[model samples]
Target chain A: MRTEKIETDVLIIGGGTAGCYAALTLASEAGGKRILIAEKANIRRSGCLAAGVNALNAYIIKGRTPQDYVEYAKKDAENIVREDLLLTMSEGLNRVTARLEELGLVILKNENGEYAARGNRNIKINGENIKPLLADAVRKCDNVQILNHVNMTDLLLADGRVCGAVGFHVDDSTVYEIHAGAVLCATGGAAGLYRPNNPGFSRHKMWYPPFNTGAGYAMGIQAGAEMTTFEMRFIALRCKDTIAPTGTIAQGVGAKQVNVFGQNYEKNYGITTSQRVYGTVEENRAGRGPCYLHTEGITGEQDKELLKAYLNMAPSQTLKWIEEEKNPSQKDVEIEGTEPYIVGGHTASGYWIDRERRTTLPGLYAAGDVAGGCPQKYVTGALVEGELAAKAIQKDLKESGADQGRYFAGQTAGNQAAAAIRGIYSHHLKKEPGPYSIDQVEEAMQKVMDQYAGGIGSGYRYNEKQLDLADEKITLLQKLAMDLKAEDMDDLLHIYEIKERLIVCRSLIAHLKARKETRWHSFGEHSDYPGKNKKYEKFVNSVLKDGRIQIIYRTLQKGDIEI
Target chain B: MSIRINKEKCVACGKCREVCPGNLIKIGVDKKAQIRHPKECWGCTSCVKECSVNAIEFFLGADIGGAGSWMLTKEEGDIRHWIIHKSDGSVKTIQINKKNSNQY
Candidate 1:
């Protein structure tokens, strides 16, 4: 195995939405500088949009301003969200979305030739090829380089600043040491952390990409960056069995949630989305039985279009409908709550970044699902964050004369870090097979999180005792993770992913324990302190120091943007 | 839902394993399509659309899907045709137009 040493101006981990857009932005503006994207999978069909998306969930359409979008986001997050990040994302949403449209994306239009609006801030689109299109656009840039199948294991930090990253090629098992002037981490969010609804072989049946095991969050935590809002995990209410997003039915086709009694129970309770999920759990716990997403009043055309939307995001739901001999035009589809996920795209949980998407750690910028403080940012907002991060990196480079030589600060420190990381991987290969397999360690972590943390087993609920157990068990699991051994390259990738997940798990437990009040309801339930307290209406930020996580609170201030 | 590969029909091209979003499939040592982890399957059917030999089959389990129902996928250029066979012997075909591959 040969080790490849590459030098570039900017290094991006994860060639998903944010990394691709960042590469595109820097290539166009950075004066012929090299931009490299290290991805775990092929960029043309990777990340959450690998199958494509049906609607632009964060578009600021006609009659709806960016301020309205920000206000709605604040409401969605229970009145405690980063107003600055939301305002910044909201202001650039339409511009970035329109740019995508010009780049060969087909935004659906109504008979009047206007953009088809789903809700107040969403527009319909035929985005089945969004990822491929973005990948193609990024490839067209001469300065951008994408290295697929390289799994980023850790950030290369020297003197508290990220100078590069270390990863290994999955196919050839060769180490890659990439040194850059700046590094952007946009590796999406953690999935498969809590026990998924369909465990075992069906574990990939999840709302988020199962492969994104919190690499971005873990790397940031290990680098001692401040992370916020891990307590406000995202628990999506999806279609039963398939775990498909219910937005296609609820918002796409104007369907409503009905009970097993064939009545509009959610409407009867006057509930919102989170309340609806809680109501369903309560109904089932009270022996009312299954709930359904009733599409009885939707027209045939609407139902057909709804299925098309499902085809874009999660086609399995449409196939399951056909296999079950059920059609939305006739009968309703069952709806259920999925396992909780720690994500920043839907919830406000990730690296604590300021206005420029810059983390507390110098030379390290966060974007996409890894950048905290904004919620409901979906695809377009990630693109905006990527663009902002790129501009900030470029401005910093220009100010420093572009050739100030960042990696020269600490050659000894860099070599020590690189050697330590290489030794960790080499030890796994040289040792006799360890007692615990990677899967067993992953299973132990997930079981502890699901049973004690705010997973579905406790009806998305948690008590103080359960949280304490989660903290203790997660710590033990973190120790156990070191003993995980691998026999092949694929196993090595899993070992790295599982290790990152445990690092993220520790932060999640610390934040959950710190937040005494139940703020986000089903998303972050605290049964011991069930009521929402105004005093606890702040962000829970944590930073690891001296082998212990120091948790703190940050006040959510109103931004000058008025959004 | 789970995907089943026709071992006899499979040419071991590994296109199905390459296109699967969940990374659930792999080529066995015997050079045949193997569903390594059936439970982790996200049922995207990218494998179904990419397999030129049309050797892959998908069906939902009895717990959710009834008996005698099946699904087959075929691609003609940019258009994918989903042939769904219902439990009642009736079949429905859905044509999904994909973005042109030549564009990129």
Candidate 2:
């Protein structure tokens, strides 16, 4: 089809929480400059917050300072979090959330007329339209152009610097070649790498956004950017049947997790939010589970607020509760351990970033779930990083001497780039049919991951033998990716999605194999190495070097650890 | 669990299809929301929320809900009431607020 070329000063991929906020920052700071956001879905309803969220998980309230917040996150991640990034993000968390409120988000208030505290650092908010709110705020900016329903396939590079990115529209199938002075990868995090809890007829049902298939991580890997913490995946303990956020019962109504014997089990493990999932899984393994979030003691007002929290995010949970004729306030709500997912939002699995949110690649930056090292970022921290990245981009533009926005003179550069990208994707248009369809390949990859790479089937437990099998199967899947064929653009999108996932999968396996210790606990349990090892506390960084995956170990610097 | 849409109550507004992130919901020839690929559905329940006529519901599946369970949403101005029918013949109701509706 049609070929369209777009030129901008900044290109933001994936208009989710980070991208939208980045667009807002760029528009407000660098007025009259062209900013483009290329999103696979409609920006107003995309990414993890598409259905909205219940609370600002990273907000620093009055009693807590930024350093205190960072310390809490560092402790939760078992001292593996990037203190520098967390400190910077925490410093801006409250301001960003307040700005969101000023931009129309309704933050719940206490009787004292202050932001109400839900837990230690989180604040309650009626964020039912958080995405739409951010979308509207970005829409008010004149220079920002949002290209909805465009799937970005690859990043464009020249002279060891990122120049732009290329993609195709989901509905129109028009090839889009975008050239930008600076590119921000905010494509959220990965899902579907492992078999979901509800497989078949509901495969897309998972904790994270299903459409966020690790495109950012994959593109970064392909571009030879250093990525970290692929081994420390994010596993959530959610509502059993609906896979809803347990925060509604836990923090919203202050419900504690209880086993089938009606014993409060989380306290036994000295659990943090991330460790709670592990605790729940271990309880189930000990035959104490079929665990439930105990909410029988909450008052009626708290129950109402708890329902409000669910309405903001995962309203289906409330719907399920209503359908099941079970009031959480009247009875304990069942909770289940979701399958492990590759996410930077909860865990620290994404691109390694500097203090300015700049990736290793020149002219490219990353934030939010795509930027690694910062865990428990949630929505507010992502917004803070987005603002940080945007501010950095604006400052860099002013100090640079190179001609900016002039390279996109006409369609030639973009067309040439588009043609080259199309060449890579041309295998999908090949006449020779491959042996496997997209679904078959996906299923095979999932099965391999589930059985070997610490998926739900393995109770998220992996050993050297399983990792070896995962390695072998993933290698075959990568080979199969090259011979894939598609009948149309939709199929082509799936092909690329699988290809990207395969790239991430290989990286995941490599990282999983490198880390011997079971550091991630329930998220990634290695049977061969059953306990946490201080030696492996450093980050497991991986990069695609000369078309091969290479692993590196980076010890956290003194400053990174101590802030 | 997959989303269930009541064809009899549907008015073919297409809001559910529009908000469905996976694009799994389609308007059949009968002008009602139909799931094209039930297996691929993300189960985000965006369709259920966007369906103002209460024509949509979410089934938690036999594995999770253990059969005989149902979920529905009732909107009252700035509040949403969720009513659940549990497998054990119990009922629960929860209310949530919807503030500043016109902002988005």
Task: Compute each candidate's TM-score over C-alphas.
Answer: 0.94, 0.92
Worst 10 residues of 2 chain A by lDDT: A402-411
- DockQ of each candidate, alpha-carbon based: 0.32, 0.32
Error of 2 at A462 (Å): 1.3
Q: What is the TM-score of chain A alone in each candidate?
A: 0.97, 0.96
How many residue pairs clash in model 2?
A: 15
* Whole-structure CA lDDT of model 2: 0.81
lDDT of each: 0.81, 0.81
Q: Over the stretch A31-144, how does candidate 2's per-residue lDDT look in tens digits?
A: 577899998877777788877776788888887799998788788877777888888988999889889988888887877999888768878777777888898888888889
After superposing candidate 2 on the true structure, give the runs of residues whose Cα lies further than 4 Å from its correct spot: A297-305, A402-404, A409-417, A430-433, A560-563, B4-17, B25-34, B49-59, B66-96, B100-104
